[model samples]
Target: MHDFPDIDYTQRFIFDESDVRGELVALERSYAEVLAKHPYPEPVAQLLGEMLAAAALLVGTLKFDGLLVLQARSLGPVSLLMVECSSEREIRGIARYDESLITPDATLQELMPDGDLTMTIDPRQGKRYQGIVGLDGVDLSACLSSYFVMSEQLPTRFWIKADGKRARGLLLQQLPAARLTDPEEREASWQHVNTLVDTLTAEELLSLNNETVLHRLFHEDAVRMFDIQPLVFRCSCSRERSANALVSLGLEDAQQLVIEHNGTVEIDCQFCNQRYLFDATDVAQLFAGGGVDTPSDTRH
Candidate 1:
């Protein structure tokens, strides 16, 4: 149980005789990488980290081929907050918030008073699908659980918490195929597990090891934990991709952008805060050639 690398691990477990399924994730570097890009306010950073962790937990439990995006669109100064996780386990996120709205006890409703919480699943070869609902819960975990109830039509629950250094979450879902029959024993077991899990404070979940936490919650039950998977922090942005975006905007606009910005069209990655600059010569070569090459950045 302790031989795996400590990046992030999501494990599927069962109670041996019950139809209930569960997942647990402990994120270390993945959570910190998302927060390292910008100096977000304390609450905003924690909320974003929790979303990222919850996304990983969700994706790990479900079977999807493409990317899954958990997004909230609001009308407040904090207009949008998004967390995207690909089927391959790559994750990235960004949060927008109003500096004036910053408060010690700000909540999800305050940040996004009139927004919709949505989960969009885009498969690589099939039509994209989306499930939309209002922001009914106070936090991301509850909001996402609401989505699970509607879209998945399953009895699901999520517990997520995070800080600047790390993020962690647990997901419990009833398998659809196994839900046809009502087993009182299984339901009672789930309730018992839930009660013990409920006792897990945010501090304990954040500080304790995964095995210890699982044992603390389900020590009485015959739970079977599976293999661990590594969850690493990664960014998808590249200079070539940025240049391609510029090209797609049309050479006229690219040139105009360079001129307006004094000889360079600079694009910054919101996830990493890395800047990609294309100058006159860069633009000329991009148009002269059908494809653009990735630019080299001198800034460390």
Candidate 2:
């Protein structure tokens, strides 16, 4: 195995003579940081890790300039699992679940039954796009694969795995009218690549580096690996954004909240546990269009 940096990153690669392109994502610190935010059950943590990895892999295949959000809402034990990845490779995620309802060995389908996965692309310069699919598949990867096939009309496959500590994913997508033009040739190439990828095991996917994984799967093929783009666990919540949220609630309601909370209304970011406080004076200044002093204890 080649020596590769064991860090959170997504690497893009393409088959030299085929119309298939791929992305490999491995998450360690980012995954750990997300898990640390809340005391999630093992099944929920593992599923959240896989969703985080899936978000990173999907973001690499897009040409957008903003945020990509992967959210799953269900009526099962886990109510919500949300993961966000920006164009800059900054990532953060959170999960909401009923601890008593979640069993130790529950599967994704059992935990998130009657759910839907929503993918939203909020671009900075253009209109936002969103696609939703029923979580009818057995896992996240299968649902997302069906999403691509139904919404994008593209042949896409995902192999994602996550333990409590680490998460990794591989995505293979067939580009349109690229190197392989003939329909039969395209189908054959797609099947060929996916067949090789099917052999990847969960342990190998979670433990191996990007290069070694690619080589092990596509050693006989011509694959061009690109530079790895680093990923980090970053919460986009800030004092200003939190203030803006407070301002959105009219002055009367904001002041009432302050009174209700004993002169301070606090906004706690669920993703990172960062607290933003607005006192009576701060709320008045915010309504008066005056700047408020930044808080010193913003870290988790």
Candidate 3:
């Protein structure tokens, strides 16, 4: 195992002479925090970590105020894998898998047979946009590459790696006609950068710092690096949000649940495993359109 620094951030870089941009993300504490909430299998954890890194990388490329979610759904052992990265760089992820069906060495195709990847961009003040692509590629990185090629009509490539403890990703994309306008030059530049990036191994991608990795890969190219943006593991679930969920159940149904559970109704957040208990009085107050005080016990 590599002794990585206590860092979790994403940095953007652009080629000075070419019309290409890129982002590199390295996640350690945020990845560990998400895994601590659930006892995921090794393969499941690795895939989830990769998804977390992928979400962060994609969100860095966009200019939205809401969130970017990367989700995969299938009918195999791993039923669902979802990761969300807010515009503020807070991330949370969860995985659903059947223990009995999971093998020690299950490939992505075996674990997620018939799966499809969905990229959703939800802005704070506009309509949400979503793009779906079939899981035709062997791994998450390849699937994402196909998404950009088909949906966005941009030439994009990704190098993603995860080992249950840390996750890192590198993305190279060709922007619209800018510094390099000639079509032939654009193609040549894209190919040249991608060809060099192809030499990057999973070990190097997961272990090296952004500067070292960039230098090792593109030392001769004129690259402009940007400031790093911090990322953290933060579940969106809160006591207020849980209370709103009880309200959505309606007073009658909410009261019945409280009665069936011996004067208390417990709501557990799947992503963070935090419990929210509403007793008879709390339920009544919620129904009365009054504020409900905090629960007696809360788990972090």
Q: What digit string (tens of lDDT, one per residue) describes model 1 on residues 82-101?
A: 89988888889999888787
Query: Relative to the unseen true structure, what is the C-alpha lDDT of residue 91 in candidate 2, on a scale of 0 to 100?
Result: 98
* Location of the lowest summed lDDT over 10 successive residues in candidate 2: 291-300
Error of 3 at 36 (Å): 0.7
lDDT score for candidate 3 against the true structure: 0.91
Q: Which lDDT tens digits does candidate 2 get at residues 155-245?
A: 8899999998989899999988878899999899899999999999998898778778989999999999999999999999988888899
Error of 2 at 153 (Å): 3.4
Report how far residue 244 has shifted in candidate 1, in Å. Answer: 2.1
Better of 1 and 2 by TM-score: 2
- Please give the CA lDDT of all the candidate structures: 0.79, 0.91, 0.91
Off by over 4 Å in 1: 1-5, 177-180, 183-189, 294-300
